[model samples]
Target: MRRIAPDHDQLLAIVAEVFREHGYEGASLALIGEATGLGKGSLYHFFPGGKEEMARAVIAHIDGWFEDNVFAPLRDGADPSAGIEQMLAVTDSYFRSGRRVCLIGAFALDDSRNLFAGQISNYFGRWITHLADALVRGRHRPAEAMELAEETVAAIQGALTLARAADDAGVFSRMLRRLRMRLGLPAKT
Candidate 1:
C-alpha cells in the first residue's frame, strides 16, 4: 500500500493560525505540535531551522495572498472606485474569517528580540509601499496617497483590534466605509 503523506500546506495553515492567535513568543513548540499533530521531532524533520523558518514561511504565504488578491486587481487598470471596492471586498473577507492579527504584525511582535527583526521591518515597509503605490495609481497625489495609505492601513489594523476585542465586526466595517468615503468613493448604500 502506498503511504499517505501529511499535507505540509495544511500543517502550515494550522501553524499560521496558532501563531496569529498566540504571539510568536507565546506559540511554543508544544502548542504547535498539538495544533498540527506533529511531534517535536516531526516538526524539526519538516523545518530544520525551526521557528524562524516557520515564521518566514507564514510571512511569505500572506505576502503572496495579499499581492494576488489585493494588489493585482487594483493594478488591473480599474477606476478608483472599482479598485477601492475590490480592496474592501478582500478586507471584508479577511476580517470575516476572524484572522484579525496580521501575519506580519504577529511575526514582528514575536520576533522583536530576534535577528529576523530587520527582515520583518522591511516586510511591512514594503507592504505599505505597495499600498501607497496603489493609492497613487488610483489618482491620489503622491504625498496624499502615501499619507492616506498609511492611515487606511493603520485604521484597518486598529479596527481589527477593536472588532476582536468588542466581538463585533461593525468596528472594522465602519472604518472601511469611512475610508471609502474619504477617498471620494460613494459609500455603500
Candidate 2:
C-alpha cells in the first residue's frame, strides 16, 4: 500500500480541525503534524512561516467559507427573510449543531488573539454587518437591524460556548429557535 500526500486544501481542512479542537495556543506543531501525518519539514514546506502562518491560512479558509456560504447570501439573496433563514441553517450545520467549536471564537478568547486580531475582527465584523444588511432588507430600521445583528451573533457565540460547557447540544438548538422567533421567522417543524 502507498501513502498519498494531502493537497493544500486537504491539509488546511485537517489543520483547521486540530485548531478547532485544541485552539490556536494549544495546537502545537507536533499536534498538527500528528493530525496531518506530515513531518515538521513537510509542514514547514507548506507553511514556511510556521504555526502562525498555518493559523492565518486556516482563518482565511474559514473566512472564505463564510464569505461564500453565509455572508454573501445575507447580502445578495433575493428574499431577505429567506437569506436570514439560510444563514441560520448554514451556521447550525457549520458549527455541527454546537457539537463543534468555532475556531475563530476560540482564538478570540485565547492569547493568540493578539496575533490575529485583525483577521478575527474582520470575520466577526463582516458577519454582523452582513446580517444587519439582511435585516434592513427585511424591513428593520437601520439601528434596530444593527442591534439585532449584534444580538444574534452574540447569542450564537454564547450558545456555542454554553453548549460545549454543558455538554448539551440542545442548548444551541434552543437558542437557534429563540433567534428565529426574535427574527420573526417561522419555527422549524
Query: Which candidate number would show the highest TM-score if scored against the true structure?
Result: 2
Tens digits of lDDT, candidate 1, 95-159: 67333766675555554436567666665565567677777887779999888877877787788
lDDT of 2 by residue, 31-134 (tens): 99999999999999999999999999999999999999999999999999998999999999999999989899999999999999999999999999999999
RMSD of each: 2.7, 0.9
Candidate 1 runs further than 4 Å off = 1-5, 97-99, 110-115
Q: Tell me how candidate 2 scores on lDDT.
A: 0.95
The 10-residue segment with the lowest total lDDT in model 1: 106-115
Go through the candidates in order and give each one's C-alpha lDDT: 0.74, 0.95
By summed lDDT, the worst window of 10 consecutive residues in model 2 runs over: 1-10
Q: Residue 12 of model 2: what lDDT? A: 98
